[model samples]
Target: MATKRPRRQAVSTCPCGLAETYEGCCGRFHRDEAAAPTAEALMRSRYSAFVRRDEPYLLRTWHPRTRPGRLDLDPGMRWTGLEILATTDGTPFHTTGTVTFRASFRGGTLHERSRFERVDGAWVYVDGDFPAA
Candidate 1:
């Protein structure tokens, strides 16, 4: 009979480049313990979700109009870090906003300007545009 090996506990850090632990940062959003207060927060949580491969969270936070029927994550690609470059109008009072960031992975960096909108008082990712090479 084969025995199940014990799962190792991995050290957690916020993939969004926040100075807090994963649980204190993006983990709360992933577990539905809290809603992101701003568009930037939502973006951070979404990036963290990509790193953790939390497909459900990503789908939940994505706007219905832009969300795909399913998500396909690249298993061989490892996310390394995130750098928020700039944000515009993503405040608590704004209905729409944009976030420009650089998400570094194993191969290279993905630079994008993502658009967001508040749906029913909750920020949701709408879409994004990659910078021209």
Candidate 2:
């Protein structure tokens, strides 16, 4: 028989640049308790997933066409914060959307315009383009 691991305790603050505590914010989406209601929300949750190094959550929310077979996250990379710069058409009423943001790490920032699509009534990450500096 295999032993099941205990659930991780929730953290105090969310790393997605949100004011809510982790459990009250992105944790719900990470745990599959709720789907992100908008493209920007999903983008925020994905950023939080990177901060927490939640590879499974990242994979699960990725679009089938774009999802990689696996992720190779740097265990030593320190994710600092996120800034949502813009959004387009990513609402409950829209099936497609885009989110532009900057994610800062210890050494630098990542600026991207990410595309998303609704798959089976759930939002999934399609891909992203790195904007020119």
Candidate 3:
């Protein structure tokens, strides 16, 4: 069937700079209501799942042994900026944390250092580091 792509509303509040928006920042982790308190809010919800290309919410917010069972994610590359270069609090945040960011994708541009996990207390997305320039 493959016909379902219309559920995005909370627009223009967090394009991944994180001042809080997109329905009060990442729409509380896409309406799960809170989770992602750092690594720039899971790099602003992985740049809002690459600006709403979603891809099963970027493979269910990844982190399953570096998740990658199936993902083509090719919709014309178009996420153009973010730079949060520095943070440390992986292995359960001390009140939550993470930052290291440099997402500017087009044909190729990746430099991450993401790893966030707070689970029961919120904050998810527990692994990342795409450095191979």
Candidate 4:
């Protein structure tokens, strides 16, 4: 019997340990065509956005009703890693979804469960609850 080869996670390309290209992984969400399959994907893409300093894309993906008036990333803060615990949907094809993640920051760490909604053929981040740091 032949054994299947193990899949490799891309360490160089993605901040997350997924054996996929940046373009194939989080970049898809930034692009207009591809839709995230789950909340984890969305969360990963969002993390990548922070790394890439793509605030515009962040705003684009954010749910407008709950979106802040402006987007600003801390200048000195360095994002270390991302750990997604669970997800609901958060895909382009879904109506509603949730993503729970632990993101490491320089000042401290952030653990949040973000909610997303798809309305009128667009996916947007709605809200999130964070644990006390």
Candidate 5:
């Protein structure tokens, strides 16, 4: 007799505050099926990566000059949401861009202005600056 298998719950909305499903949104980028066309898109995908604890994706998308050797994500941290406040020139026409956003966790929110640049025609994260409270 074959035993019953547990059903997988489908996620309707993406963690990056997008209306599309995860698989169609950031999941596609995370799976390396496509590259983010704009800096904001890359920023959104990076946020989703943090929410999902996808360290490899994070590292892979980081600029080599600034990429860390490894990531140390806290297993206990629960990401709640991501809110993009502003974006400056990280479009396909520009080589560099900045995305200011707020990423909320279970306890608090992290606000940052992240930088991005194009390397080999692909958008990659460089670094970020935290504004004073």
Candidate 6:
């Protein structure tokens, strides 16, 4: 007789590590139900996009000045976690902001200070600088 294998369950937790479930968090933004209200939120959503391999969402939220025409996500890369370290001037009143965070992948971690700007009342990722390893 052959042994039965357990079925893989769907992930409920948000990849950004800030929400209890994907639907209550990044999924809202990904599904076009809501827009990120702050730079931190946008950053978190972007991280979730990476985990889901949603290149269109990533590109849509990226600033046009720095956004690439196409995104080539590595199939071997798996995002494991995210840790936000700091935020600066990302309020609704602010036009530019920065968010520093660490994103852990399958075999490595990325530490970056990302820049964002409000364009047409929507927050968009501009660029990021990696910290020294």
What lDDT does the true structure give each of the candidates?
0.94, 0.95, 0.69, 0.77, 0.96, 0.94
What is the per-residue lDDT of model 3 for residues 22-115, given as tens digits with 9 covering 90 to 100?
Answer: 7777766766676665556666776787777777766776666667887887787788777777777743437555667777767656787777
Give the residue spans of candidate 5 off by over 4 A.
Answer: 1-10
Please list the residue runs of candidate 6 whose C-alpha ends up more than 4 Å from where it truly belongs after superposition: 1-11
In model 6, what is the error at residue 107, expressed in angstroms? 1.0
**Between which residue pairs do clashes occur in model 4?**
9-19, 10-18, 10-19, 63-125
Global CA lDDT computed for model 5: 0.96
> Considering TM-score, which of the candidate structures 2 and 6 is the better prediction for this target?
2
Which stretch of 10 consecutive residues in model 4 shows the poorest summed lDDT? 10-19
The digit string of per-residue lDDT tens for model 4 on 1-133 reads: 9999999974567765477878778877787568665656766887888877889878887877877877879777798888888787666556788888888877778899888777666656778998565
- Deviating ranges (above 4 Å) for candidate 1: 1-11
lDDT of 6 by residue, 40-75 (tens): 999999999999999999999999999999999998
Model 4 regions lying over 4 Å from their true place: 1-11, 89-94
Q: Candidate 5 residues 90-118, lDDT tens each?
A: 99999999999999999999999999999
Off by over 4 Å in 3: 1-41, 44-48, 55-84, 107-120, 124-133
Model 4 residue 1 distance off true place after TM-score fit, in angstroms = 46
Alpha-carbon shift of residue 115 in model 6 (angstroms): 0.2
What is candidate 4's local distance difference test score?
0.77
- The best candidate by lDDT is 5
